[model samples]
Structures are given as C-alpha cells and as structure tokens.
Target: MTNYVGSCLCGAVTFEIEAEFESFYLCHCKHCQKDTGSAFAANLFSQTGKLIWCSGEDNISSFTLAGSQHQKSFCKDCGTALPNNHSSGILVVPAGCLDTDVAVIPTAHIFMSSKASWESNVVNIRKLEGLPE
Candidate 1:
C-alpha cells in the first residue's frame, strides 16, 4: 500500500503510484538509450500498482515503437518521463520521476549487450558535484 507521488519537470503533470515495486532495473537497451538520450534507463516495475493521475493528465503523451514492445510516456510540456501501465498489466515507472526517494535499490542491469561502449567503467571516472572549472 505504499504511495509514491511524482510530477513532470515543468510541474504540468502529477501522479501517484500505489503498490510496492517488484523490481528496479537499469536498462541498457538501444531503444532505452535513444529514448532517454542516456547510457541507461532506470525503471521500476510493479505488477499490481495502481496509477492515479492527480493533475494535468491531458498533458501526458505516450509513444510505442512501431515494430517493438518498447514504449514510453512523458509530459508534453517538459517531456519528463512518466509511469506507463502496459496492456499486460505491468506498470513501468521511471525512477527519476518520483518526487520522493524509493527504498528499493536497482535489482539489475538488463540488456547489457546493447550497452554503450563509452558507458563502460564509468564508475572509474572522477566524481564532481558540479561542472568542472
């Protein structure tokens, strides 16, 4: 019965997810990289979660890859990723979209074969709190 609240970057859309996430995954699929414009996508999956759109529901947009099962939901204004409930009854939530922290750590990194070459050994890179001088 846990409730997780979230909103888009522009605050144009808000929502709530009620249920414990079964797993959190860092997906490195090419489709994920293209959609997120990043090395990987952090996502939470829940089989029985309930989604409640609290505001600006009409501002939400979704896209499904024509030849694949890949799909994504976002806010039309700022294009922040949002939760999507698939036809198979699974709920997918972008971890970054949550307003509060989630207790579950990422369960695994998936589709590693498609992981970007430059993304390798990223942990060895120097950490910076902000842009380097």
Candidate 2:
C-alpha cells in the first residue's frame, strides 16, 4: 500500500508505483553490470504494483535482451534507468530513480557467481561524504 514516485536524471520521464514492493535485490548479473555500468543493480520488485506515468511518457524507452527475460527501461534523454513492467506481471523498478525515500532494504544480492572480482572486501573500503580532495 506504499506509493513511490520517481523520475529520470534529466527529468524527462516521471512515474508512480502504487503498491508495496515485495522484494529488493542487488543484481550482479553481467547484463545488469553492463547496463548500469556499476558493480550491481539495485531493484525493487512488486507483483501487484501499478505503474502510472505522470509526465514525459514518450521519453521512456525499453529494451529486452533477445532470448532472455532481461529487460531495461530508461529515459531516452539522460539514459537514467526506469521501471520495467514485464508482461509476466512483475514490475521491476530501479531503486536509484525514486525521489522518495524507500523503507525497504535489499532482500538479497543475486547472481553472486557473476559479482565483480574487484568487489572483494568492499565493505572495508574507505567511506567519503564527497569526492576526494
């Protein structure tokens, strides 16, 4: 029964999700790493959520990998990831795109076998509030 609002980095696409997320996952699949250009993709999944496009819906584009369930939706302007409402009735929303603070934490890290080799002992890495001087 939680509602979440999100927009793209360029503010070209906006949407609202009206349902509680069933799970949150940090995905380390190669496809996710390549699309996000990061160690993993933080995603929130909901089976019954409804996606409401608030603005700039035309700016949203989607791509589904051939022969795979892997799909990505993004803002065509800034390339920021957005929600993917799959035909299978699962809605996958990128956690980073939400403007609202999420109460749900990651439920698990998936595809660990494909986790980046450089991510070893990442918890021990130095924490900085800003870019190094």
Q: Which consecutive 10 residues in model 1 have the weakest lDDT in total?
A: 81-90
lDDT of 1: 0.95
TM-score of 2: 0.97
Could you tell me which residue pairs clash in candidate 1?
none
| Best candidate according to lDDT | 1
- Measured with C-alpha atoms, the lDDT of residue 121 in candidate 2 is 88
Superposition TM-score, candidate 1 onto the true structure: 0.97
Q: How far in Å is the alpha carbon of 15 misplaced in model 2?
A: 1.2
lDDT string for model 1 (6-113, tens) is 999999999989989999999999999999999999999999999999999999999999989899999999999999997678999999999988999999999999
Give the residue spans of candidate 2 off by over 4 A: none
Off by over 4 Å in 1: none
